[model samples]
Target chain A: MQKEVMFAGFGGQGILLSAKLLAHAAMNQGAEVMWIPSYGPEMRGGTAYCTVIVSDRLIGSPIVKNPTHLVAMNRPSLEKFAPVVKSDGVVMINSSLIPVRSGRDDVDELIVPANDAAIEVGSVRCANIIAVAAFAARSKMVDLEILRECVKSQFASKAKLIPLNMAAFDKGLELAEGK
Target chain B: MAKVLMKGNEAIGEAAIRAGCLNYFAYPITPQSEVAEYLAKRLPEAGGTFVQGESEVAVGYMIFGAAACGERVMTTSSSPGVSLMSEAISYIAGARCPAVFVNIMRGGPGLGGILPSQGDYFQATKGGGHGDYHMLVMAPDGVQEAVEMTMQAFPLAEKYRGPVMIMGDGMIGQMMEPVEFPEDLYVPPTNKDEWATNGMDTRKSDTKNIVKSLYLDPTVLNDHNLLLKSQYDRMKEEEVRFENYNTDGDYQALIVSYGTMSRVCKTAIDEMKAQGLEIGMVRPKTLFPFPEKAIHDAASKPGCKVVVSIEMSMGQMVEDVERVVKGKTPVQWYGQCGGEVPTPQKVMEHIQSLLNS
Candidate 1:
């Protein structure tokens, strides 16, 4: 099975990192994965996004026009991408900041209070991690163990921050499970 | 061989190292500056030379000096800087010096932009410098090809006794992909005592071997040009490479593209196929020894109504397409110059419009 996922948010929302982590996890699972970022001048404060494609076969196109899943960390991302999700596709929305729900009924929508959940975990910045956990739980595209391995590998060089990030990931998984 | 994730620019640098290129001289330019930066650290570890020359002009001359000593040498730059080095490139060609020059092409007519573009098609294939010479140009679409072609360029240059160009765009330079270095590849040390001007006593003959492009006599210049033309003719016979996609069936449209632009075309072809539009793509893997026969064959196809030349330039390779098509088919051109890449949707639209018309 081939799946395309887009994670989009403001520049500081860790959207690119989250997409990379997903790609890394997919790679660890022996899936062919490609992570492409919105490069060039649009990379300033403007809404940044990355498209990750995980496929059991060779990936033909890296650019995804219609994604199978979307992790919308902010309102603009939801507004921009809600309509493009495939039928029965999962969209994990950060409801703490986005007031409205997806207008499309053809797809599955999960409204997790990502920001509020992060705050409960003592850091609002871990909202992306929360969204990632929700995506893993809903899609099962990658195993939680592989995701944890990706998180560890990402923070391996910085041993001090590993505990906090691991805690953040576990907290995210817990929040998704509770939902 | 094991795979390692590497950027295109860094892979070129590593490939150059594996190809036994001991000397590298370059000035920084976007999309390709990473090659210079990478070699600066990697070269010393491999016991090679890496110099950030004062300017592109100086770097070109430094390449000339190193190449004259029979050392495996290389240099890299983007559009404008490449333009600056053209003079030296011409000199190198005329002097029959073997070296590798990589242009990680960015947009251009003059300082156009820093984004990736295939605008240098004419500049690269038609000889950017002032001379009746041709550099063996290889256009790599992916990262693996980029590394492989670059490693192959060094020996090819030596065999041809001329410059070889690894022409790629910003995407191929900046994008990260998996690459595997050749297992047996290693840099061979140059025998400095052979042709090098290190000391007079070590020379084979008392007379000096002058490596100059200047031949004042018209007859001598004519002979030199004829010799270079023959080399190019031989290159055309041996060096053309292209990849054909979905060309077996009758195609309504024939798409010709190269470098990063071809990747976009592949996406467009897939999309068009879903919509029931029969399209075929001829992606040139080498620009100079262009697949003229392949282009001609595609154009000569009975159902192939239009030949669309998609490029990142304002219609440079279109001229070559026209030449090959020779008025048998309507050769059309679509391009976005100065680092703007064409989208698959846009290309599909162009093809669809042509099919409808």
Candidate 2:
């Protein structure tokens, strides 16, 4: 009933936004959740990261040193956080860019070619959505339908982008299910 | 009444508006700037006013001015910014104005890292500013508690006719969680006709009201100090709130903490408990009231061997714990400062070391 996820990537890669999408979906499902972002200078360019904790019970200490899930969008993130994930946890790596594997044997590793899948869906920016969708499909932690609804509302101000992002998400979900 | 996920800072701002906060003036600072940002837009809709003051110092005075006029006013800042407002805070204290200030503290003595820290424990619980005074300080561990504390702060400030503070760390300020504002918090505004300076016409008297902290006579100042001291004592008696967890049976150690750090300790206590080392925890909800008696009682438990003060500072709240324990129990301090929050594992290690030693 409790899940802690650490999502890490480059500054502009939509790591924080993807986490928000997950948080919004979780809220709709009546789960308690907390999304805490690293509010420092890495936000301008270096490595960006955020911690998302979704629990059925009250969440304690949003800062998770060891997470149950880690979505690493790049190599450095995977190398840094992969080892720290709790045993039997899930680690989703953006294999298109990471080009490295989680060395740990205890965790369930999912290597999704997120960037390549995003290219198939039309925009590189959609890679985060794709990776998170793959994560959702692999874990089944949140409903994909609810996730799509969250995505639609999140981009309600820009209606034109919904179809493209949805396509990206579906593609990611399909690929992740195949794996 | 529906629950919505909100950032901690944004929720605090909304709670203020729901509590009928009429004026907000604060400068932008990391970790807490979201509070001002959220208010900048929402305050207008709530029929309230918002001002991005030129600096923290200026914003402090603006809050003082609004509070002096008997309006529900609030401002928020991080460590260094709070330091800048200490001078005005002191003056507001001396003048006996009811205002709310929130410190989403960051690590500090200087422009330290913009991460959650309890380093301001001394600055907040003790006197941040000079001149014998205290601001009623409330510490919240999570976003929901943050909202509730903020809503309660307005009435507490009004009742005391003195400043009240909501203290949290950057983690609490930046995190997002589901919360629902109580319908009653959106109650009608408080009456400010009594002590406020709403022009001479509003008072309907010949004498004009002057708001100043200066008292030329030492005897008069002494009287003012005594009044403030008495109010503080009253607060201690009536407002001391704390939560004791898993302390029913004999426990090997007692952990004392507040704000976000307390939750971290709770997690560590669970781990220690599973290891057959019974660790009880006392979390203070109101820091200024100190919960001295509760702490003393917890430390006086039959099996309690030591009281550990867990903080995000070098060691500050430990002093209060030590003072209250009065050597009744061995008081220990463990912390990580300058943006490094201690993980439960780290805390358990500290606890285990204490148990062994």
Q: Find the candidate with the highest TM-score and give its number.
A: 2
Chain B TM-score, candidates in order: 0.94, 0.96
Best-performing candidate as measured by DockQ: 2
lDDT of 2 by residue, B1-357 (tens): 788889999999999988988699999999998998898998888888999989999999998899888888999999999999999999988888889999999978799888889999888878889989999999999999999999999888877778899999998999888899986765444545556776776565556667778999999989889998998999998898889988888899999988888888887887778888899999999999999999999999887999999999999999999999888999999999988888888989988888888
**Which digits, one per residue and each the tens of the lDDT, describe model 1 over residues B1-357?**
646656789999999988888799999988788899999999999999999999999999998989877788999899899899999999999988888999999877798777888888888889899978899999988788899898888877776678899899888887665568885554354444444444476665566566778999999999988888888888899888899988989889899998888878887897788888889989888888899999999888999999999998889999999999999999999988755676788888888887788
Question: Share of real interface contacts recovered by each model?
Answer: 0.06, 0.72
CA RMSD, predictions in order = 3.4, 1.8
Tell me the TM-score of model 2.
Answer: 0.96
TM-score of each: 0.87, 0.96
The per-residue C-alpha lDDT of model 2 at residue B105 equals 92
lDDT of the candidates, in the order given: 0.84, 0.88
